[model samples]
Target: MAQVLEFKLPDLGEGLTEAEIVRWLVQVGDVVTVDQPVVEVETAKAMVEVPCPYGGVVTARYGEEGSELPVGAPLLTVAVGEPSAEPEGSGNVLVGYGTQAPAARRRRVRSAPAGTAAGTGPADRTAAPRNGHAVQPAAAPATAHARVTAPAAARPQATAPAPAEGPVPVISPLVRKLARDNGLDLRQLAGSGPDGLILRADVEGALLTGTAPARTAEETVVRTPVAPAAGDGTRIPLKGVRGAVADKLSRSRREIPDATCWVDADATELMRARAAMNAAGGPKISVLAMLARICTAALARFPELNSYVDTEAREVVRLDHVHLGFAAQTERGLVVPVVRDAHARDTESLTAEFARLTESARGGTLTPGELTGGTFTLNNYGVFGVDGSTPIINHPEAAMLGVGRIVPRPWVHEGELAVRQVVQLSLTFDHRVCDGGTAGGFLRYVADCVEQPAVLLRTM
Candidate 1:
């Protein structure tokens, strides 16, 4: 007996919705195993290699390469036992979830040339104008039916006269800037340079004509105030992570009625722990790592905060596992890479994971997986020496905690006033799932853990 299965595009994390097929690794008539990478999909940020979740003989391919397909749409059909046409409604397989459809095969076309004008057909030189005549183009030099002609040898003729010397080369902008600063007349300076090109040495020679050392542009000290240009000031187009962050933050603000709870903490012990840990040095972990660790621990203590408010269902599903997303600043913009199941890991593991995520993020190596599945988030503004800031929650995550810088501040210690390293924690939660008391307590738990680093072990 022969059976067939179809593979469809899976929900590629986040609300990706759709993806463009970059390339197909397997083709019809090829045998493939379950979980083997069969196709490469290009999303907005990366080209993710998606694996086949069902083992079968590929029978038909439904979509061609370079086509955009929605999640849950059939990609290809495979014969699990026998080949057959796709069944109604059931052929739409979810990657890791269903059967592939019989895809149509077509050679993928290259992307359209950027800025190509619509309605303008491919250029035809045959109809072009030349010398007041509509000239039909001469046949291209090499073709199968074209005649091959060889030129006759040149007669023993007189040698042609030598070519005249061309015009002198002009000075470059940098060279001119250098010359002006050096007070050298560019014209009077006969270039000792080849092809009359002015070299920096030539400019220096002109300046050195008098006393005191002559200076070339490189050696000159000249400063000029830059004038404002005619257009409106710098216009920055919002796109990529920065644009995504703005959109998300706006949505979170509008949809989720958010409330914040703040807590002050003595970061002396936390700072000491960080220094000691860095001394042992595997991955030089920082205060942010410790803060992320504390945030995860606090979320574990309060599962209510680890849930998203389902407005449609009118319910909050508290997650059983921890997927903690941390805010990272990169040259591209802000990104949050999640540490999946963070509650299962110890401080060392968590620190290593956080370091890995941040390094990958900064290097722009983060896969869509690392950017999604976050049930909670932590954003550290402490690096900028701020006391606290209310970071917007990464949408779909219930809450986000902001960690501020650790600085020495006066506080009553025992009976007398003393300087203590203090940092602030700002917790912003979805008001629908968390009340002020719950939110406050959850923040207080994190603050307590940071205040006493040893308490984290017990909490974990």
Candidate 2:
């Protein structure tokens, strides 16, 4: 006897309501252990691998890659306990959502003959479980078909064809696959399950009646969407990381009355200081770390910019401690990973933290917590070879510092025209939090430190 356990998507935490399926690690008929990573998903905050709670043979997967599923939606099913081969020990189990124990079980039937790929086959008439109900698999055909689909666990009720227009009334993924493989439009069938839900019997009935797509039709027409030809223009859905970024920036633009102030400063001293420190035979300090240190010092003098405006409370909340967020653009999208207690850390620590976070961001392994809770943000757009940008405030945060590329430029040094490494710095702050005077002082101090690295030593 085998009990088919239905596994639904779990709450990924941090108020995430849904996730887009990125890839499936296992397929139908694959044996898995408890807590094995079954699927990889991309949520608004980060990429996560979801683990299965039950160890058994994978029977079916609900959603396809690139499909979005809400939390608690059916992800897959596994035949636990009764499946022949079992692993020696359970691997690392993730404490995800809870699942119901098997209520009952029955042996699978193998009487029916296996069918073809383009036609109906032996359906795993397992009464699919839902909403914490124990699965009660029905007696299934023993024959292994070229393509077999899982049947929804439903009570004994007269099944009928569902409407063709609007959403399809199918519950069993196995039935969906069967109709899909045979090219039977489910819209043409009336469902018999509760609430007109299409069941496996409905699909099998259609196949037996020759309503399935003919051999020539199956060969010519497929259910999958074809790629757009060149010049056809492609439409990528705004979802996942890209969608999250779009929403956050749009909200920042809509709610924050932001203003930008920028200035070009001689960064020759800062560059020389970095070279000196690295030449001292220690971990090389990056320019971003140097600027981060400068920002922290500047924030101490003008803490007003290191705060966010609470609209509901109608107050400007100034944070005493700084959780610094630095922007890093990766293959997925732009992500700001926060370094906790950044204000308390030195230049060397900031450099190490920035490197770690940047690596995590590039690999798409940042957690939701690491991606949020920042008092201020540092945008080093200079890495992209851009000199300047009036950066949008990362919503809920009061200000952001933008750094441009440092390039050699002729400038007046001590009343003498000379070539100096120069860089542009911009500050975008919420007008509600601070006025131009405070913002100006902060930027001026930062520029002063860049012109003379010794000024940062006093802040130390």
Candidate 3:
């Protein structure tokens, strides 16, 4: 006899409460090894492949694809210790496993009478049958006859009659929100999903057809405003990376009293210095890395900008090491990947670290640790071709430095009018951590370094 074991979804870290099932890697009856990925789930952070801890034959899967399941919900059940020989699990931590183990012996439940499986109670439907036996309802002859005679349009219409009682069949909270946002009532629509499970498509279809009821004045007033539409206006849920960014930025605006100070720096020398370094070449250093190196030097001179305020303790905690975070925009969203101990690394090392972290950010493989713990941020919005922006401070951090494009502009060099490569640098600092004078001194030092790269050598 095979012992069936239930595997629940493990905690994927970073306080994730739930994950949406994106795809199923394994199916029922498929033999799987320990730590083999069974399903790919999308948390608010990233897409993660969840692995099974026990090696066995997959018996049943719980949630449907696109359905969100809370942590600790049963993901799938496996039959272990079968007659067929299979290797045991290696007991490695993939995500993180639950402490509870499956029962040593399987409990037998009373089977529903034949032909009544469709009408069976929820408890009977949810319980797994002994020995991996499938509990299927017998086909109803009358239902088949009615379906064959009904027209295609009539069939869908008839199948989806309004529910008389009980809760709605919708499973995803997102689907519910979508319906509520569009003023579609869940009780009226027929679900196209398995066992009348209302899906997002069902609600969307009702909206497109104008079948969804119009919202009352009160409902319309309460509904959140939708994003600007180009064509038919597709709504993207702000749940994953986009949602996190929204929440953090909103909080930063609410809590931090930040001020911005900017200076136009002559970056011709910095650009020339970069060209000389790359020409002397081993690994070609990027302009962003050079700016990051300058940032660390300036922070060393003005440590107040490189600190955070601890509200709970009522103290300004100045950090000893510089954990530099740089903003990188990818298809997922804008993510700040932190470079640990950046103050200690040389320009070459900084370039390499930036390249590695940027690659990880683009690939969406950055861990929560890499995405956090920054004393200061260096945002190079120059890549976007913008001149300048008063950027928001990444919350809890004291300040952020924004860099604009370096372009040749006419300037007076040594009392002679000439063209020089110029860049605009802006520093947004938390007012609580420092006053205008301290912030001005920090920006002036950065500008001096940009104008004459030799100033960084003194710190070096």
Ranking according to lDDT, highest score first: 3, 2, 1
lDDT tens per residue, model 1, 297-383? 787778899999888988899999888888888886888898988878767788889888888888765787778788998888877
Give the higher-lDDT candidate: 1 or 3. Answer: 3
lDDT of 2 by residue, 1-460 (tens): 7655666677777677768889999987899987788999999888888878778888768766866666766688787775333212233333233233321222253444544223222122344345434233344433333222322332233444455457796765766886776567887776654456675656766666666544454344553334222223444555678878998999999999999999999999999999999999889898899899999999999999999998999999999999999998988888899999998998899999999999999988788889889999999999999999999999999999999999999999999999999999999999999899989899999999999989877867
Candidate 3: list runs displaced more than 4 Å: 62-67, 82-91, 94-214, 221-232
Q: What lDDT would candidate 1 get against the real structure?
A: 0.64
Q: Which candidate gets the maximum TM-score versus the true structure?
A: 3
Give the range where candidate 1 is weakest over 10 consecutive residues by summed lDDT.
Answer: 148-157
lDDT of 3 by residue, 357-432 (tens): 9988787667767887899999999999999999999999999999999999998888999999999999999999
Error in Å for residue 173 of model 1: 47
lDDT of each: 0.64, 0.76, 0.76
